[model samples]
Target: MRGPSAWSVADRELMAAFVSKVNGSAFCIGAHSATAERAYQDGAKVRAVLTDLDSAPVAEGLRATLRMLGTLTGAGTVSADDMREVLSAGVTRDQIGDALAVCAAFDTTNRLADAFGFESPGPGGFEAGADHLLKRGYR
Candidate 1:
């Protein structure tokens, strides 16, 4: 699994959480929720972003990046110009790549989990993974 880099771990978890929510994968959503909460001091911020990305209080660049990810998830295409626009917004290349990677990975994972009929184990399912992520620091 890809780990968070220079970007806030909270942001990475939020991305996973958002993708899981979009895919309606209860397992992933629960897991990511716990991971996010464990990784960030401001867990509520992650929840807020997961709840309504547009209204989430995050940096303008990150918000734009999330919007880009949403478009990619829905449309399956991101123009070169669109890439340039995001890059110009001060988003590093690695950050963009990592976000895209997380989005793509969750897309596949969500499908598999749902196709296999896996259900979320409720709120605490994230504990195991959260332990590892938390030990690694908040990023």
Candidate 2:
């Protein structure tokens, strides 16, 4: 999930998990959640965000981006007005673009995971995968 963008690895991972959650992709949710926890060094925050974004302790920009992505993933389209809301939350268009790229990638991955009936390997495997991702990234 590493890339040249303002969004940190933690944010990208969390967004991936969130998108997977929205798509009901259990494997990607657990996998990306583990990576996000490792990146943030705090698993509770990821749980909080998944449980409820409004109460989660994250930046408004990130929250706004997540909300926008939720709508996009759920609906398969993002209206210009919804994008305006994200931009109004002090999230620059470039940052939204970055977040959108992450969301788009995960959306496809989540779909493939569901279509193929992927399953979570287990908590330990998730952690190990997270370690690998944090160290090696997507390159």
- Cα RMSD to native, each candidate? 3.1, 1.0
Off by over 4 Å in 1: 1-4, 136-139
Sliding window of 10 residues with minimal summed lDDT for model 2: 1-10
Error of 1 at 49 (Å): 0.9
61-126 in candidate 2: lDDT tens per residue?
Answer: 899899999999999899999998888889887888888888889999998988998878999999
> Cα lDDT of all candidates, in order?
0.78, 0.92
Question: Can you write out model 1's per-residue Cα lDDT over 6-124, one digit (the tens) per residue?
Answer: 57777787777787887778888888878877777677777887788779878877887877877777777888877887788899999899889889988898889889988666666
Candidate that scores best on TM-score: 2
Please report the candidate that would top lDDT against the real structure: 2
Q: lDDT (0-100) at residue 128 of candidate 2?
A: 98
**How much is 117 displaced in model 2, in angstroms?**
2.2
Listed in order, each prediction's TM-score against the native is 0.82, 0.96
